[model samples]
Target: MRDPNFSHKQMSAPDRLPTRGLPSNSVTPSGRNGVSSRGGEINERIADRIVRVQWDLTNLKDFWKVHSSPHRSERLAEYLNAELKVLEWMPFQAYDQNERVDYLLLKNFLRNQLSEVHRDAELDSKVLAFLGGFFPLRMANMIEARQRVDDLYHKKAAESLVECTKRIILVKELIVSEKETAEPIVALRATKNLEEFKGHWQEWYNFYDGYDPLFSYWISEPYPKLQKALQDLIDTIKKVCLGLETEDEDTIVGEPIGRSGILEALDTEVIPYTPEELISIAQKEYAWCETEMEKAGHALGFQHWRSALEHVKDLYVEPGKQPSLVRDLTREATAYIRKHDSATVPPVCAETIQTFMMSPKAQKMNPFFLGGDEIIVSYPTQTMSHEQKLMSLRGNNIHFARATVFHEMIPGHHLHMHYMARHRPYRQIFETPFCIEGWAFYWEMVLWDSPSWQKTPENRIGMLFWRMHRCARIIFSLKYHLGEMTAEECVELLIDMVGHERATAEGEVRRSVMGDYGPLYQAGYMLGGLQLYALRQEVVENGDWSEKEFHDTFLKANQLNIELFRALILGEELDKDYKSQWKFYEEIKRD
Candidate 1:
């Protein structure tokens, strides 16, 4: 099956165009305001049309159906071509930097879409040209540098074994020199080089791993030996710089401890919580949630808390119905948020959030509302068995649906994406899951603190289930990556600790491990939320800014690395050598 996430463009040849002496027409005017009067009008008109077409396409009951259809692809390509032709007549120089960036990004996205549908070398060349025009000089230089490295690899492919070995030795020396320095930047550079070497070595090793007569004549045992050496070097460097070890030490020691990929990517330290510490936190929250469930059971007149949960799950709409319980919950959450003026929901986002049913193939994963004011609610299909429907509905109960709506819409991903679309278009490249997922998760924490939303004990329990789930995500995902836990163990942990149904727990584990979600993605929810929370305490809680002021300011800053977000919020001057030292989670009280 085709991966729904990626486009279908197949590369033929590399496009390497130098940045110097690019046509002057490609350069945009320098200013914060988008474009001059006439240019702005034209750009706005084009952008509006694009948005209209996109909305029309995305609002379909089966958007993916259209996406996968050949006829639909042809039509889309035609539409995009017409749009590109209109854009070509507009003078790029008249537009400001932000407008230019948006225009280029839009153009690139459209062209890539077109390319996926119909492979065109000419279109690909135009796409590359737009990319060169869009990127800053520094970024272009970096791309050129990478291209040169690729060129060298091809050059060595035809060379003698002796020459290739000599080149390898030179690269190895460079790697060792970079690793010798203890500076963080140097360590980072060394890590990147090691990664590059590993890729290059792997390609060569694959050809020689088996007895391929054409390649075997030239390649020898030295190839596998070099691969092993590169692997060892990579492992060693990761251990020293990333605080990662090859084996789990928790069994020998009392508690598990290691650096998390998520924390490292966010430029933060490993959380101060040990495995035991995290387990303790989870246990406390779990017990509190159980108590809340008991109270809810009594309030609902149920014999047991499990019965209350089951009843809530049964509140979902029947299989093929509109106005899903989830949708209703979202509307309620949005109305409440608006009443309190907790955060401003952009008018566009408020109007554009449309709910659609997830396809059968997609229903295996959790129902997700993506960033762009679009919600995909998973429901049982007509062909599904009774057991499947029961499992599906039970996994997404009223309380769970209510708790998640705000996280995915309004003041969560929708609002964040809306702001990011207009402001700091150039900085969109710097987006990380830590900021994106973290911002949404931060809203969850914020709404939970507000009494207006989480009024009922059941609602509180629902919210806490998600919070504890995030904590479990951190512990389980990190442990799995560190070779301390298996996917089954992670699933069991969810089922036992968080009261997840066996099927739901298995699905969650599968999604976490099998999907494109990175090693740090699961951890990002809780960790990122805590990071933002810590920043809020330092900035807003201290009276430097109001809660609304802080949140609005943060949205305006665009998606940034957590440390960069801190630097921007605190008005700290940053230097090239600056490293993350902010232990935001250190002072966080888990319970």
Candidate 2:
């Protein structure tokens, strides 16, 4: 799975799709004008100006971000900071609550972008530090110089390409004899960067290759030479590196974004909690799940919940039977939600739900369900090893499928996309896990709270297994990012604390950490769900809104940081210098 948090459905599918947000270099389109439009030409709000600034910065980044150019990074950062300074001119206090929410979002969004630019530059420096002087910065400058002026000296471009090729050849030799072995993760990062550099060079060359006679004559012969040298260098480094294992399916090589990186990511997600505090939140959730699991175990005539959990995990629908089971569960969960009026499930969304089997390779990374537009079912197939098959079977048992079917389809991811796609589609740029996976997880909490779906002891344990798993995700994921836990340690925690099968645990940890997810993503499930639950308490339980109305309003609001949404929903007047001060978990704090 390329992205693990992409959830209009999962990040784009469900759990596994908890695809993290856009790439550091990707541009988010600021809506045509204004963040809000009720109908024909609503008055332009300050959000419009802020998004336009994003638009301007996004364009500046387009040309400024020349591969391997520090000036590109520095200039982009300076531009963003200048925009922030420009924002000081806005009359913030005069703005209404909705306008204020946009202002806060834009401010945080800008700051988060700046932090990421810093993180990128820092990571680039670290990775290049291990490059052993093999980097061809002159080539980077050539690329940068070309972008600076549309009319380039074609002959000069060709000369530079020839020179870069010679440099690359020499660099490969230096690497081959290099005594200092780079860290596997850093080496892999360097390898990827080098490849991108190779690509950038090719792109730069091709633009003038045949189009310009002098450029073609000078660059054509040398271009492939440089490309080959880049590849050779990449190959040599991979051979020398520890973590660059391409052969083993089980090898998980993730670059741990230390505490500083984790903190930057959390800020980007608008999560106020420290990684330490978040671990505590996960601990409480784990303890609560434990208490509930015990009651469910006791109901099932077992003294310990682990015994009951194991009992449930062992009960599966045999090989060919899983597909039917998933289909039936999807219908059952859909019907149940509709019957309970838990959320507004349009006929189209329910009727349009689709299912597919996961390939054996995909199953290695995400040995569970994935959802959004379609439900990706992960059950054992003929290709898997017998042991692998057993793990898949146990990991995705009938009750486990029942617990998450709606999560990947219907009222979970499918419904999320169904509503979000139709309403406020522009806001999808701000997609966060809290809304994607969190909303799906929130429904899990909602169903568990009401007690209609998990009628049997087996079902209760099944649901509790996932609930505990989400808690473990937070603790292990944050700890991994904080440099306190290894991927293997995180995997061990899942198997030990959450009763995950070894294969599922490894796949889960691999995708969560090694895949392209932000640091705080795993925490979003329990945290985002809890935030929604807290909001539910305030609105439905304490105030006038009904469950359907509350759910509908939130779904319609699309992807916002849960904190930002809090302001919109509650109509809170933010202080001039606002931060995520919502101690949302405090309302559910237990002694």
Candidate 3:
């Protein structure tokens, strides 16, 4: 039942973006604002209208406090649809590239929000359906009423609370008496939905519990009874449905969003390629990485890439010396990015890079590292078994650290945050992992192409290890969400294809598909990388902007979607009917 692959052209041997070498410490930002502060050519009137609409959304959301209420949901959807129509009809034919791009991205954002509303409602329905057609949504109605500051009837409201309590008791009894139930995701959502309903009831109750003496007099007794009944229902469902009494951190449980859900999310990111097309691109990248690894392996006196990978894994620093190693690697990468003029490294970003060691407990879920503000280093602790200690050490080897240290520190996530805060900072609301993570992943590709970054064959292998890992992430994540692969299959694919440690593979799989992330997250690393890579070709490699100029412009644009960013950089003619169809990667045959 696997999906067929689709077309996306790629370079047989990718070329580098241009730059002139500069000294490391000499890399200082120009102009008062931050980096190369070329006076921006923004169309103020059009841009302001878009921002004004964003503020309208902000105010509207502030008013709609009860998110799950059918009335609020319908109202919000209608509001968004109206905005979409206005933007659709708005005269943008005379606007410049920058203004049209702003218009284009905002329109897509509204459309994505609407589609996601439907997706969310689909999930919400599972909760009520699992409860056999009763979900206690009356409390959300009360909550909405409170949000509106409607005239409160103390006696009637108290009776409504008593009725909700009765409903909770009935649901709890039904769960306990039932012989069968919905699938795990439904039951799991049912418990979560119950807790949410309980919270809504509390929100309705607390608005006047202490503020109005008469309201408290009526609600105080029944409120506690309803609260207790809600808690009871949640517990009973968890025990009877999930068959577990406590949270299981190690077991990976993810609700797969089918092809339609996947397509909707990709559309939101402004990614024109289908999931099948992206997977095919990833496979090509994977093949290229293998070939490069073999070349590196030969230089490392090994006949095979796997053997070279094993040798690199054993290149870890001694215990208790990782902190110093990170400090040194961060310095190395900071120097490299500047030497190549890859991107501007503000003096503050270089000085303020921070590091913190990850605990053994946290390492089970994140066996490698986490970035932004501070790089959370994951390695062995004093209490771990010998096997766990060795796995952690090899997983965070010196070579591996060297490959991604810049990614976590300067010229990667840390610098990304620094620039985003300084330039077009308000656009943080429109941020996407495709830009955030893609920027970092794009750096990985650029550095790999740099002669100095990966100085040795082992260095190339170290960088290639992460490249292959990104490829594997795209494959496993998409397949899992498309119902073509299970979580176990995903873990196995990591271990078997990417050469990941069993424990490390499990951790990566869990982190990839967890509830906190969308299904396309894992695929973002390489997909985003390849996107920026292709865009670099058009803007820097072939266009008038030098590498430094291109990088500087992108950081300041606050462009969340790369395709829209492309429009801004290229300044091509854009009218109202613009759509995303950039085939950034063009395939070439290698000798």
Candidate 4:
């Protein structure tokens, strides 16, 4: 189930509001901030009040810490009073459209928080009313409100079902209109739109099933039917866009950027390796890894890999023993990077990273580390089955942990996020996984060559495991998307070629295909890495530039397709029809 507040894409203003029930006045007007006729004074007053309330709430020292304390009710009451004070000041009808939307969203956020903190049914009703009044068109809010009302009143479930039917009809209209567009580009756009709509609708249904027992009981049968209808529409649209029935189809369906569309979208050159080429690369790495494992007194099989992983796990802090391991490792990596002057590590980034245990429900997903200002690490719990425990430990051993810590934190994702947030905020819409994932992968390669980080053969083997995994990702993901491989085949490839445990390989495949990541995201790790490596060799290694100089320049340039990045750094002329010419992987010498 999707968290209502969480979105994988960066939240736009409209996204912050409820998707279904937005009021007529909710949409922001084009010219200016859509100032109301009442005057600027009122708008300023409303904005000022919201700002002050936010400041007051945020400024309270240890406020969040107090949320889980024994006196939580008392703290919540005080917080609600402060929030009410802000709400009292808001002139919802008098403010500009932008200000009004902001005011409503803020109000909704506060109300929702209060309801959750206090478990107050009355407050929940009030929230429902507030959402319904402002966001009347949104199906998600309507369903939620209906459920809450039904819970409170013991009403018949027919009303919510009717509302669901209405929503389905409306969506059907959208789907039909979407398919009416016959032009390839327009059809492709429609495919994306439908996919997004289906995802959101599925989330709405899943959220109800997971969170609201009453709603789930009534809607259980209808939910699967609705989901299938959505999927059928999506599949139909994809078929038309990809020109599957045509003999000389040009488009890749759902992907507008061509066969190398992912690369083009990332402003990168086409990936140099074919499926066979990538498989060969993975095989070579596999053989090398086998040699390394033998030297470490392990053999080249699943059992030996498991034993080697256990040995490495034993060397590190035992799972669930202490929270200090990640933090200590992060600090050590930061210090090393700074000492070598490899790249600038911002103080804010180093200080702001927080760590937490991965939840049991999320264990099957096998999330090793998720990056933001905070990095989330998954570790095995006491309640986990032996297989689950093995899966967790197999992929997050001491050497693997050390190899990936910098990639998730420091001069990797955290630093990249920090710099981009401050310097090139507008370029966020152009974000592609290639540039983002590539940058981190490039650093892994860089540190591999640096004796300071990969000081031992074990560390090198750990690093190589991930490198080989990245290569395998490109091969398997591309094959899956091209209809040459199945999800099971992809899983087997990971297990056989990358030495992943059976469960771990399955989880990896699930994450790559069924998760929020795009079709090309798996490939981005290695392909992007190769793009950066080639660019570095051409510019920094050949031209007059130090490693630090090249890295600083690259980071500051913000996220761009590797091709445009090259053009910007090299001062090359760019054309609208520019296509990738560089075959980066072909230049590599494999022993």
The RMSD of every model to the true structure, in order and in angstroms, is 17.7, 8.6, 9.6, 17.2
TM-score on alpha carbons, each prediction: 0.55, 0.85, 0.84, 0.57
Which digits, one per residue and each the tens of the lDDT, describe model 4 over residues 308-406? 544554555577653566777788888987998977777777778878777766656654756656788877788979877777776777777777888
Which regions of candidate 1 are displaced past 4 Å? 1-311, 367-372, 589-591
* CA lDDT, every model vs. true structure: 0.56, 0.75, 0.75, 0.58
Off by over 4 Å in 3: 1-44, 58-67, 132-135, 151-158, 198-221, 359-365, 383-387, 587-591
* TM-score of candidate 4 on Cα atoms, chains taken together: 0.57
lDDT of 2 at 60: 79
What lDDT would candidate 2 get against the real structure?
0.75
Tell me model 4's lDDT, rounded to 2 decimals: 0.58
Candidate 1 residue-wise lDDT, 1-591, digit = tens: 112222212312221111222244544323423443222333454445445545544543123221222334555666667655556655554443223333444454454445445642333333223222221122223233343433323223324334434444544454455633243323333444445545644554464446455455444544555555545655555566445466522111111223443333333222444444544554554576577667877888887776776666666556555346766776777787678876666666688777777765565556332334588776667776787767776667667777777888777887888888876544564455678888989988877766566557667657767876787887787777666787678888887766776666766777776566656677777777878888887766766566776676678667566656665444343332245566666645444
Off by over 4 Å in 2: 1-44, 50-68, 132-134, 144-159, 169-185, 202-217, 246-249, 301-303, 589-591
Backbone clash total for model 4 is 11
TM-score of model number 3: 0.84
Model 3 scores a C-alpha lDDT of: 0.75
